[model samples]
Target chain A: MNIHEYQAKALFEKFGIAVPKGAAAKFPEEFDTALSQLPEGTTVVKSQIHAGGRGKGTFKSGFKGGVKLCKSKAEAKEVAGKMLGETLVTVQTGPAGRKVQTVYFTTASSIKKEYYLAILLDRATSRPVIVASTEGGVEIEKVAHETPEKIFKVFIDPAYGLADYQVRELVFKLGLNAAEQKAASKLIRGLYTLFWETDASMVEINPLITTTTDGVEALDAKVSFDDNSLYRHPEIVALRDLNEEDPKEVEASKHALSYIALDGNIACLVNGAGLAMSTMDIIKHFGGNPANFLDVGGGASREQVVAAFKIILTDPKVKGILVNIFGGIMDCNIIANGIVDAVKEVGLKLPLVVRLEGNNVVAGKETLAKSGLTITSGDSMADAAQKIVKLVA
Target chain B: MAIFVHEKTKILVQGITGSFGARHAQLSLDYGTLVVAGVTPGKGGQFFEHNGHKVPIFNSVADAAVATGATVSAIFVPPPFAADAILECSDAGLDLAVAITEGIPIRDMVRVKRAMQGKKTRLVGPNCPGLVTPGTGPKSSGGCRIGISPGYIHQKGHVGVVSRSGTLTYEAVWQLTSKGIGQSTCVGIGGDPVNGTSHLDVIKAFNDDPDTHGIIMIGEIGGTAEVEAAKWIKANVKKPVAGFIAGATAPAGRRMGHAGAIVGGTEDTAAAKIAAFKAAGIEVAVTPSDMADALIRAAKAQNVKLS
Candidate 1:
């Protein structure tokens, strides 16, 4: 649901938010053409991947990790060719890392002022709030921590839309005078339009910077759309960066793991994510390691359940598999049946511990009671995690 | 009779005739949720019966609302049609829309939310365990055996139970019923971050009811919703509110099953909510059984003697 900086900036530009003039180059040969297309002199070649921490930590000082600043077309092409099809492992890419497929060629903007602007759903207020800070570029969370009041927020009513009045308020608050207000208004409006059209959960223009020319531009753009809302926007679907994602996550999507990879080795597969995290924590509480975090969600099918089982088992280091299903909407008997089928088909040699609750627990227990699949059924989430740790240890 | 829906609150199933739709329709009718119409977009003018109440399945919520005066909708469509289904109900002006579909994208919810702006229609959740009013009767119109427990578990008195965890609510209800601590209403608002009615929204409704004397709140880790509700409980709740936060198994640094249940830091932990509620002078339960025990104790402290 996250679009690349180039695509986000392009959308920003369409709405009159000035972005560094750039084009995404898919092929190494396309780099020259793409660079020539942009106003040439000094350009920033940004590595296009889903993760962050890219420019400095990931790539070597200037010419490593596919992201390099070059003055000549030949240098840009050389860097692009080296980075193309190469898997770049950056901090943002996570421990497993993702393959670099595309790179963005952008004309570096000369900045006089750097400010941060982002809009997110504030759960406390139950409304979309626009967060703006005079200080940009660095982590906004840190800035909020150091100087909380500098980050002014304006709660937006979905009914009225983001008004020009709010933008004017922000423009003045950010210390921009008359000339800057006109351009800043355009950027805010463009972001709002893109936010609506893309069904984005977040649209952040970090470094809503001012150029030496006294004009405003969005130096970097980050837009995260709601995955559930992807059905309405097909155009955004094509920009998915699948290569730079977790293998288990990719497998989980089709197999439906509701899986979010985390640091652990116990491989907790619970019926709900809330319950799953607790299960993983309890494993650690009892001196155990969780291999990954997976949620089957409510009312999962036998196939989906089996698929989740397969995904967990795929991790070779997974010493134990914890299946904790509260069985709220889903029946415990159905879950038991799925677990039985999964053990038979997938061959569960790993130690298995389960805590199934809810409707038909008796039947579910009866089904699992007879299954001699090296499984132990606990009475509670804590008890189950404790048992899984005992078995694994 | 239930306040919003009863045996006669003309109902419409947005994906009527679909497998889940048909199954829940049969159950809902049995539980006293009067389902009057079914909509399948292309498969209108079809006839389906649940508990001998001929539910005329229409093509859309608008059409069904018009044809049968259906004022409520229970959506059982696939996750993909969730937004459209809710919007259809809101546009048709259903008093309340309960979305039973799980895995609805957050983006779709924002749009659906935008669509419901300024409207009277209130949505439950795109991924929730449908509403339950216990006994007089229930939304069993969908026949989801999950929500329909042994009617004996609830005593139909004055306890309002609200939870983010779906099945946990049923466990509490079942235990309360066995103890003869029946409820006025028990709502299982699903764990998704952008669900329609929040814990506070449901609690306010419970507060207005004269029949309700005490409240039991169940929350998991993740999101500030529970914390926000705790603040509300401290400020406005007149009745004794007993609480339990599940996800004791949730580790310190990961998102649990509910998108909102992830522990961001020590402050956002389940322990944090329990402490806040305790500081606010609300009774706290450590486990499901403890939750039942706490509610019983809370009820007794308020001196509401049950037969």
Candidate 2:
């Protein structure tokens, strides 16, 4: 759903918003070509990863910064060389961090002022809201907590879209001049249109900076589109970088399952998103760490269950497995049969705990009981977690 | 005394003949729901027969409502066209619409929510299990189900359950039903990152219903809706409320499958929600099955007897 900064800036340009002259380089060898295309000035080399806090992020190679300012093209190439292939560890990216697969070479500009602007869905109101503040280049969350007065928000009615007066009001609140206000108004309107047209969940311009040229520029952009709407935008879906994602997770998605790997000993397989979370919660409550989170969706067939089992076993850290399902429209008997068949085919070595409830539950329990496998049957959600955690411990 | 659907609630199936719609429609009709008509664009003048019972199909909700006098609609349309279906239902001036479609674009839902403003139609979910009220009269057309929640797992009782998750709703209902507790109604508001209904809406409905003496609220991480509901319950709701939140062990940033299950900060986490519930004098269940025990205690505290 999230696109890199270069892609976001390109989309911004398509929407008539101005961004610093930049080019995305996938390889360090292309760094010279990227620097040559950009405006002749001090260039900024930014490592493009999903997680933020790149300026202060450290590379696995002990390189100083994920983002660096280079006064010369040679320095730009050197910095890109350091960041192009290394894994970046920021405050947002965990210790393992993300590999720097792409880098953006942008012309560094002298900023007259920096302001934060974003369009996002306000859950409480069920409306897309435009949030702006004079303070930028720092954590907006901190500004919200400490100096709430500096932040301003305008909730745009989906029926009417963003009004011209609303944009002017935000511009006025941010203390922009007549010329800058006019320019800011245009940019805001374009950004809002882009958000609406693309079904973007969030379009953030952290530090929508005023350049020395006295014009508005989206300094650092982050655009995330609504995943549900991607079907209408095939062009956007093509922007997905599989290399940036966990391979196991990509594989799980191919099977119509949701999986997120974690550092734990217990592997959880549950139907329904909320139940999966509860399963993990109870696992931790019983003093067990879940190695991964996997949701086989409301309905799972024998093949899907086998696929899920195989994915869990792929994690060498998994000590035990827990299968929790509450079948409503989904039949519990199908789940039980799938479990038995999975263990038979995959040859499970780790202890497995399963708790089935709802439709055909009696048959489901009977099926699991007669499987003659070494799987433990849980009486309830709590019992399943306790059983799996204890067995793993 | 149920909150939404009961006897006399005529049901219509939107996107009828679609795999999900047809399957649930047949199941609901068998379970005793009064299904009067089906609507699929260009499939008008057709008859969808199941179990020797024929349902007349209409081109639009407007024509269907006019012909069948259907007041409620359960939608199983695909996500891309779901918003338009909801708008059509609302436009037809239906009493309630249970949207079973998931993955509706937020932008589309934003427009849908706006279109629903001040409208007669009350929208339940875009990604939910739907609403159910048990104990309708046999002659009544409103069946045992309005959504995907199993009809067999419920019994007519005093507890009203409203949840944000689909399967978790069934789990709680199963626990209560197995323990001899019955439900007046159950609603899943869906897990969309931004939805049409909220915990507050369902809780307020339960609060006003005389049949619902105790309430079960199931929430998860990611939104302040639960905390807000707790505050509202403390001030207005007189019935004993039992609460449970999923994702207590979930880490930050990772969305637990549900679009709305991402922990935004420390505030929306399970610990914060449970603390809010306890602070509001509601019984908090540590586990899903513990909901039965909590509900029993809640009902007992209010001098409401089970059985």
Candidate 3:
């Protein structure tokens, strides 16, 4: 659901929010052409990745920063050459880091001041909250924790939309000048529109800077859309970069299975989200690390279960597999039959433990017992988790 | 006495003609719930005949309520129209509207929640398993089964259960049932960030119901609803309360299948919630399987009888 900085800035421009004019290049050959589009000035070369902390990130090629301020067009092109196709490791991007597939070149702005601005749902109020702060270009959480008074929030009424007064209040709180205030108000309005119209989960601009000319602009844009509402906005969905995601996760999504890989040996397959999460928790509690979190959903059909098994087995680190189903409306017999068929198809050798309960549980257990597969059946979730952990150990 | 539903509660189904809705409708009918009406916007004047029970279908929630005298509605409309379905129930002034549909846009729910501010209807979920009050018959057959939960897993007794996840709720209920413990009512408030009801709402309801002696509250990472409910239980309620928080192993910023189940900040993490629960004197289940036993431990410490 997260889009790169360049993609977000493109969206910002489409929504009438001012962003520094930028062009992206996928190859070193395109770097000069991309730099040519920008006005002759100090250009900013940013490595395109989905994670934050890009400016402080280090590339695998021993290049200093993922984001660089080049003095000339040639320098920007050189920086872009160093970044493209290089892996960037940031605080957000784990140790493996994300490979830079694109590099963005933009006209660097002369900042008079920086302010933090974001729009997201405040879960407590169930309303969109505009979070702004005088302290910008840094982690907002750090600011909120250190100088709590610097942060200001304005919750907007979804029914009436964002009010003019709310924008004015944010502008005043950020201490914008008369010229900057007008621009900030308009920018905030546009940002909210982009957030609501595109079904964005969050729209954040770190260091929303005011140039020497008193014109306000989003210096850094981070926008993520709601996955559920993606159906309504095909344009937004088109921005999704499959390269940034794990291949197994992408494959799981294609199969309608919820899969998140972790660095462990015990793979967990559960029926629901909460159960899947807790299945991981219980594994850790019982002194076993979870390899992945996979939820087969309510209907765990034969094909879906088989697909889930295939996805889980892709992780060679997975030493054992645990199938936990608290099938309320789901037929346990169907799940058991699916497991039996999946095991035969995949020819699984790792220790497999299953705990099936609820509707038609007796038949389900009987099916597992008669499958001619060496599957361990546990009496409860605790028992099943213990069995798998022991088997893996 | 159950908090929201009982044996006498008349239930209506929205989008009953759909496969998902019809399937659960048949299950509810099999469980002996009084499924009085179905609403499918132009499927009016038709009957949803299942197991010899010919439930009438209406064009609108208003007509359905008027014709069938239904007080509650279980919504199974698709995400795009689910919010509108909830709004229809609110306009018709139904007592409760349990939205069983998932994947509703947060924007729509925000507007729906705001529009229903002072309305008569109490919304349970836009992505939930709904509520169940177990019957006294075999496998608890005759009780009010509003949503998609398996009725046979429940037993009519004194313990009250509330959870964010559907299967986890069933896990806790099954654990209790296996221990010969019965529940007064079990409610799933859904796992969306912006749901109709909160843990605090259900906790307060359970606290007021005299028949509900012990409580099992199941929550996950993300949001402070569980913390709020735990704090309230510490202050006002004398009932024995046991709590379990999932997603302890969930990495931060990752959405754990559920739209709402994400570790956002320091305050909403599982560790923070568990600490809050412990601070409020609520027994915390170390694992999901220990949920029923944790409640029993709480009940024993408080000299309270749960069934």
Candidate 4:
């Protein structure tokens, strides 16, 4: 759903939003080629990753600053070399961080002023809103919390697009000069169009700069599209970076199961999203950390249950597995049998706990009991969590 | 006596010829819902027989509505065509349209919401578990089940249950039902990032209902809906309310199962919503199991007869 900064910038350019010339390079050796496309003066080498706070992020190689201001192509090459193959740890990226597979090299711009601009769906209003502020190059969340008055918002009516008066008010509140205001209005309009056209969930340009040379340019870009709408846009789906996502998650997606790996030893497999979260919460509340959050969905067939178990077992940290299902449309017998089959196939070594409720629950429990597997079946959620915690702990 | 659908509310099934649509349609009909008509493009004049009874299928919602006089529609259309189905139902001047489809693109919903500005239809769940009114009319034998949740989990009682998650709604309802605390009606506003109905809409309906004595509201981390609902309850609702929120231990920035369950900002968290509920004099359930007990206690304190 989230695209890299270079990809976002490319989208910005495609939408007629001015952005500095840049090229993405996979290797340090290709830095020269990328730099040649830029103004050849001062270039900014930005590490390409999904997480924000990259400027302050440190590379695993002990190279400071994910973003490097390089005066020479050799310096850019050195920075890119240090970052291209190294793992980056930012405030946004967890302690384990993401491996930087690509680096963006772009021409540095002379900025007279910086402004924060983003277009996101506001939850309260249930509409797409444009958020702008005079403060830039800092965490907008912190700015909003500290100086709430500084942040200005304009909610867009999706039916009519961004209203003319709304854009005019936003630009005026941004406090730009006459010519700069004109350009800002055009840029904001184009960005809104891109947001609507591409079905983007968020389009953020931190430090939308009023450059000394150009009228306006996006210094940094982060864009995420609505995943549900991706079917209508095949081109957007192709931009998904498999490297940036957890392998287990991507694999789970292929199987239509929702899985997010966590740092724990108890792997949880639940039927629904809400139930899955409650399962995890109960596991944690009972003093057991869940290894992963996995929801097999409502209508999971036996094959999908098997696939979910396989995905959970793939995480070697899993010391115990808890299968908590409240089958409605999902059959309990299929899940119970699938667990037995998956355990037989994967050669289950970890302690297993099973809890089945809802329709066909008695049949499901009977199926599990008849499977002759060493599974601990619990009566309730609390009982299940306690049993799993005791076994894992 | 229920908030949304009851015995007299004639139901129409959209996308009726499809497997998903037909499955739930049959289930709804079997549950004693008066499913008079079905809509499937190009399947006009077809009959979908269920339990020895034939329900007529039409090419469009307008034709289906005109023929069947069905005011309520349950949508089983796929995600891509779901918005159009809602629009069609809305365009036909249906009273309520329950959209059971999940993964509807927010863009399409945005347009759908815009088109519904002054429309007669009230949309529920582009990714929700539909509404069920358990305690009204003769046909409410299985409680007029229109959504995905099993009818066996519900009973005819005074508590009004509204939730954001479907399975969780079932969990809460099952607990309430098993403990002899039957529900008057239960509604899943849905767990999509952008949905049609909200806790406020459903709670307002519950507040106006004469059958609903006390209410059990289930929310998760996301949106300011719960917080806003708390404020509304403080101002308007007279009934005793018990609240439960899932995903208390969920990690920040993680989409805890539901697309709409993400913690977007500081205000949209379990802690924040729980605090808001407490501030509004609503009983808060700490754990999922505690929800039924909490609601019972709240109802007892307010002189609500649970049995």
TM-score of chain B, candidates 1 onward in order: 0.90, 0.96, 0.99, 0.97
Q: Please report, as a residue range, the 10-residue window in candidate 1 chain B with the lowest summed lDDT.
A: B139-148
Name the TM-score of candidate 3: 0.99
Tens digits of per-residue lDDT for model 3 on A303-372? 9989999999999999999999987887889889999999999999999999999889999999999999
| Candidate achieving higher lDDT, 2 or 4 | 2
Q: Which parts of model 3 have CA positions greater than 4 angstroms off?
A: none
Specify the poorest-scoring 10-residue window by lDDT in model 3 chain A: A32-41
Error of 1 at A11 (Å): 3.4
In model 2, pairs of residues that clash are B33-B143, B34-B141
In order, candidate lDDTs are 0.73, 0.88, 0.94, 0.87
TM-score of each: 0.85, 0.97, 0.99, 0.98
Structural similarity of chain A in candidate 3, as TM-score: 0.98
Candidate 4 on A1-393: residue-level lDDT in tens? 999999988988888999988999987678778878776568889999999889899988888999989997677877788898899999999899889999999888899999999999987777899999999988899999999899999988877888899999998998888889889999999999999999998899999999875498899999998888999999899899999899999999999999999899999998888888888888988899999889988876778878888899889899999988887666778777887898888788889999888877888899888888899998888899899999988
Models, CA RMSD each: 4.2, 1.8, 0.9, 1.5
* Per-residue alpha-carbon lDDT of candidate 1 for residues B193-300, written as tens digits (9 for 90 to 100): 777888888888887877677788888876767777888888998788888787665555444556566565556777788788887668887555566778778767
Better of 2 and 4 by DockQ: 2
Which RMSD does model 4 reach against the true structure? 1.5
Q: Best-fitting candidate, measured by DockQ?
A: 3
Candidate that scores best on TM-score: 3
Count of clashes, each model: 34, 2, 0, 0
